[model samples]
Target: MRLSERLRGKRILITGVTGFVGEALLHRILADLPDTTVVALVRPKGSLSGRSRMEQVLNKKIFESSRNAAGGTTELLEQRIDVVEGDLSTIPGLPTGMDIVIHCAGDVSFDPPIDEAFRTNVLGTQQLLEKIEASSPDTHYVHVSTAYVSGRRRGAIPEGPVDHVVDWRTEAKWGQAMRDRVEETSRSPGILSKLRKEAEREHRRAGPITAAQDAERRRNEWVQKKLVEAGGERARSLGWTDVYTFTKAMGERVVEEFAQRMSVTVARPSIIESALETPHPGWIEGFKMADPLILAYGRGELPEFPASPDAIMDVVPVDHVVNAILAAAAESPEKGKPAYYHMASGARNPFTYAKVYEYIREYFDENPFDMSERGAVRLATWRFPGGERVERILAMSERAHKIAEYVVTHAPRGERIRKIAREVDQLQRRLEFLRRYMDLYRPYVEAELLFTDDRLMELYHRLEEADKEDFPFDTGIVDWRHYMVEVHCPNVTESMRKYDVIRRRRGRSAPTVAKELPESGEILAAFDMDGTLLSSNVIETYLWLRMPELDRTERVREIGTMLRKVPGFIRAERRDRGAFLRSVYRRYAGADLEELENIVDSVLAKHVLERVSAAALRQVRAHRAAGHRTVLITGAIRPLTRPLEPLFDEIVAAELATDDRGRCTGYLSGPPLVGESRAAWLIRYAGQHGFDLTKSYAYADSHSDLPMLEAVGRPVAVSPDVHLWRRARKGRWPVEEWKTSSAANRLAIPFADELPAERTS
Candidate 1:
């Protein structure tokens, strides 16, 4: 069949669209069957990262061969796919006219809880089947089950029905509720009986089918050993080590029974290696054995293993599995019996795990990642057991954590304890100096010559049928070597980053540069306290901020209005056109800079309160009406800003400003920065004071006001001028106007304080 005819406007839905294998499957399916409509059933978390990841793979060069073979761009193929939000456990309210449903949503873990594992894999499959049976009964069911589900049996595990048995181990060992679930879940007679029943069901569903049905089977040893008491002894007697194989055994049994009525074909794919085509090369994510095996070889960990140097490990590319699935669906036998194909690797080209490791070693050396070898090791081992001996390594980590915690708590001597503590800390330095190998990375490299891809190649062949004529899904058209060499490797190599974290004693960092200005005996705050605090501008803040275009009359009137509202209050408009900025030294632009500081000391001593803001608290308290924390930051000396202190959790302002006579100067000396200057000052303040600027907020008026706005993670512009207005529009910032004196606002606030008027300049 032509690729287009194979699809022929067929509507299909596939799950796990974001995964490495899932992505490849979509590309291959769409590449071969151009007329098929593909929909991705993305998990909920898929919404978080957005489409960047999906796009990254689709944009690779490996698929160019696919394009040449199938002859189409990724964008052209993508237009056919629509993303759908759905998980295996949850049924999506899909449209009624769906044709085929492919259940590829599965966790790749060999070890998963039997119940939850089944819930996602087997049960999820059942749930999807239920949907098809109910909504789209005519929909064909194509399932991709792993080849390893053959249980750990030696020799050629035939492509046939899996033998299942009663899992008494699950029932006898788990809790009452868990046990009840096992009984609830066991719809099949048994694994062994279930496989035989599949043939019988096939005869009834259609006619007698020749192909053997595929069933999954395994013996869960991990669960029995750990969760179950005395599991070690039982596992030794039963001969199973991992729950993956054990649960898989049960899953195979489930499939045998479920496939009875549904058009099901299980593709038992063995150890899926990198990529076969579609997305290209090794477009894989997370850590696979190959990655670590190669990592170790580069650094030199394992030189050899127990396996034969040339024994074929039966590895197939993800693309091959997807192709097999597509093919099985296309070639549904007249007999309704579920077909199972054991996708094996050595059937064509024999390669060993040892050789695979060698290639990885060569790749690692040839393709070094960012960071030195130490960083590479860190990246290589970021899991529970990591790449080392699990139990031993965990014990060592616990010891280190315990020792670090103990040292931190034991340093409380007296006046001399502080000194002695510092001295004792030197021991860490000594220990570090003794450890020369710490910087050197570990070694245990695996060569890549072992990885072979014949099975995948077979799947890549797009061919014609007696009636179905055309190579629609052929990967032979793709350029695999070019892909693995150039494109896929770069994408995987540069995605993650690492950083160092340090612990410092609390309250010991230096004061922010802004905070230090007042104490430096420079600058001053000429606060015209009243109207500035009372103005509707401050209350409106981040929202509804419009920059005011001011003539000299308006600026002077604003200053005058503020002065009259608060007697004996210094008046300062938001500096730089309501920028709310001023120099740390109150350095007058182009003025004799030294003179300002010299005179500032004599002018600042008058303030008694710490920090003050009439509008901020009212707004916060209004938010309290809706429920929120209220805070304020100011440039006035502490005593001056202190009156509004109770209204806020934090009030960062100039420290107590003093004069030459050690008396109140009333001129408001010291660096009393406001607005953008306030924002810059805030950054230094956070660094010194250890504040969370990302979580904190600041409110101000005017365009120059934006610096302070930018400083805080949350910036609110209150009655800003033209500049801020232009910015907020371009930046798509939220805007709202809050009138402090408005009756509605006053009623909304829990504490009502009348705002002071603007002082005259």
Candidate 2:
């Protein structure tokens, strides 16, 4: 009988209908097997119901032809498809009299947390089989699995059950228990201490609340990372490539136990790529197994191939895999043992990594991806150094990227620094992506397994000529060079490039300022002095004011003294802004206060005013126009802040204590206005002035001002440092880049060339 004839009018239940394979299978059935009724088991997502989610899937471009054949998407769903709401973990009650159950749902992450892998693949499959036995014992079951379940085995692997001694139930139990073990290890004194120290480095200046929260977040991340590492190690120890394949093999064992009760078949396909013929050639959803490496090579991010050049890369088109699945579902095994079929290409027509690289290079060299201002991306001949050596090289590159980022991030703020920082960030992100890619794919790429498809080929031979024409899955027919160069590469690049454009647009659309402002006296707009209102920092401002007081030789000596302590001062600044301010201010001890005040007044026009940001001035003027009180809260000395007193209603700045002789003592008259102290002062000031903090705004550029920003309803980050930028992005706060006058770049400061390059906090 024809394959479509056998499936016509049959009631089939499908899981993972939203996934790539399941959706393509559904579309194929709807287009070929007329009168068939399919029940799709889908889990509810966020606010969308199962039916709504299925509707969205039907709206995809891949289903266009199927939808048109059924008159429309609504008609297709109503007349042929039924959406059931449940997942394999819960195993909802099956629809009555199911003729077949095609189980397609499984976690596909290469190294997911062990618990998650077992829950979705091993335990979920067991529950599903039990449900099938209780609901419809006569139903023919077809379990979709991966050919890589062969694991570390080499040579030709035939269609059969995996050889193993471990019990499936015990393994599932152990895998699920891995999470608790990893969590306990994460909380050990040594691990917890390391995590806490890293968190403090990132968030100490933001205050105790932010630091504590960051520490907890780091602990959770550490636990998750440990769980993934444990899963990978356990899989490798048991001879499997990763947690995904290990759990999948366990799932097969579970299915075998239920084989005696009913007719069953297991279809294991090799690495599935874009569609070859059905739903139009080159149809694809997201990046598949090999797409990431291919794209990385094309973008010139990966300098070398990590796989053995002579190793066969068994790849089959998604449409071929889907067809084989349907063919297997049609020919169910007789009652006792389940039939196993390998839907792969290596046994019939092998394609090697060298051939893949040759084709990819040819295609890319002829048609290169334009990298905007950098022109076309240049491709290089890869030296196939294998996975381990490539990983070592990637590690070295990552370290170099980190060092470059550190230098760029610490450079003095300017247009040049901003450009370099951006480039460094991009390079760092690419390196991290490549590292993760290698971690997940190294096992598969380096493996020497060759999957044989004897059972699948026999099944194809059994089909009538008409059935063979209607459903073709013979792997020998695939043309590697034509498919790789003409179909798959074009499809991936076209789809992924559009996604890149959309992502860039979304990144640039983050609002920099609030659109609406009320005209009320109770509202407040608070600003931070250095780096927010002006381009200058305390070090630069101090040099501009104090350098002229000494001769060139004395000035050089003073700069050398301060430069030696810059690293320690930076560390102290990260730990406590108050302490850093006190230490840096001590350099002014024994200097005349009258002379310092006079120098500050004299430099107001040429040095300070020229450094003021025009964007910040406009914001203050807008606040004043709206009848909102404006305040400048800073750790800069009172004398230095005196020039900006007229711009704000109040100026709260540090004041140096003096001795009876009127010489500077270099001691703050009060606690430094930073971190938690800044927040507390703002709260008290608001209470006394009758201002509503919930309706007010605060702006700053340093992580030390995190507490003050958190105290207000609307907080803005102005040209913020890396720490502040991360917090602002997480909180969905407004971020503005305020530029200072161009003349500020030419301001003369002592030892500008000799001081270690560093960014202002």
Give all candidates' CA lDDT scores.
Answer: 0.46, 0.85
- The residue-level lDDT of candidate 1 at 592 comes to 27
Cα TM-score per model: 0.47, 0.87
Q: Residues 316-373, candidate 2: write the lDDT tens digits.
A: 9999988889888987789888999999998889899999999999888877876766
Q: How many residue pairs clash in each candidate?
A: 106, 0
What is the Cα-based lDDT of residue 301 in candidate 2? 82
State the TM-score for model 1: 0.47
User: After aligning candidate 2 to the native by TM-score, how far in Å is the CA of 269 from where it should be?
Assistant: 0.5
